[model samples]
Target: MGSNYHINNVNGPAIFGDNGRMEINNGTDAATLLRLADQLVERMRVESPALVPQAQVIQGELAQDGRPADRGRIRAALETIGIGVAAGSGGLALAQEIGRVLGL
Candidate 1:
């Protein structure tokens, strides 16, 4: 198996399997994903407050359940997060990985 990489892309989490292919949910059923992520954000408040607004932007991009997600907006949101965090943050790394997959 390859390394596990987590991305909250609008399409949902994507995993790279042993075959070097990305396996993702067909579309998105993540209606409440951002809501759940917000719960985690609460814990992060004392540590990384700057991420709160970035998280909000990401939450805004989440798709309604049973709908096709906006992959482009999701990517853009990642870029926005990249701007708000340190270079070494997971958000930047995730965005880079996603860009590689997207041929950007």
Candidate 2:
């Protein structure tokens, strides 16, 4: 059987597979999250160009292939731009998905 883990401030819970592997639901896998991060960066480039650099750093980290990255920095950067990831929101879901992918 698999187990579910609910993280505070995140939109959805994550599942631990029978093989002890973690997976997020609804296609929120690593690649998808990375794509989402890229989209976010692009949107920021237009709407908030000043924050694009921070988003780029996140994109770089995501491109590092499961290497350890700074979740705090990512969160801080988003927060600095008033982007809070509330429950059930796409932002929260994406962040949670990224966290799972990065093994945070």
- Using lDDT as the measure, which candidate wins? 2
Q: Would you list the C-alpha lDDT of every candidate in the order shown?
A: 0.52, 0.61
Model 1 residue 101 CA deviation in Å: 7.8
Model 1: residues >4 Å from true position, as ranges?
Answer: 1-48, 90-104
Root-mean-square deviation per candidate: 9.7, 8.2
| 1-104: candidate 1 lDDT, tens digit per residue | 78755556534324653356565544433544554445434533543577666555545555345774466666675566567656775555554544444333
**Model 1: which residue pairs collide?**
none
Per-prediction backbone clash count: 0, 0
TM-score for each predicted model, relative to the true structure: 0.40, 0.53
Strongest candidate by TM-score: 2
- The 10 consecutive residues of candidate 2 with the worst lDDT sum are 9-18
Per-residue lDDT of 83 in model 1: 72
RMSD of 1: 9.7
Looking at model 1, residue 50 earns an lDDT score of: 72
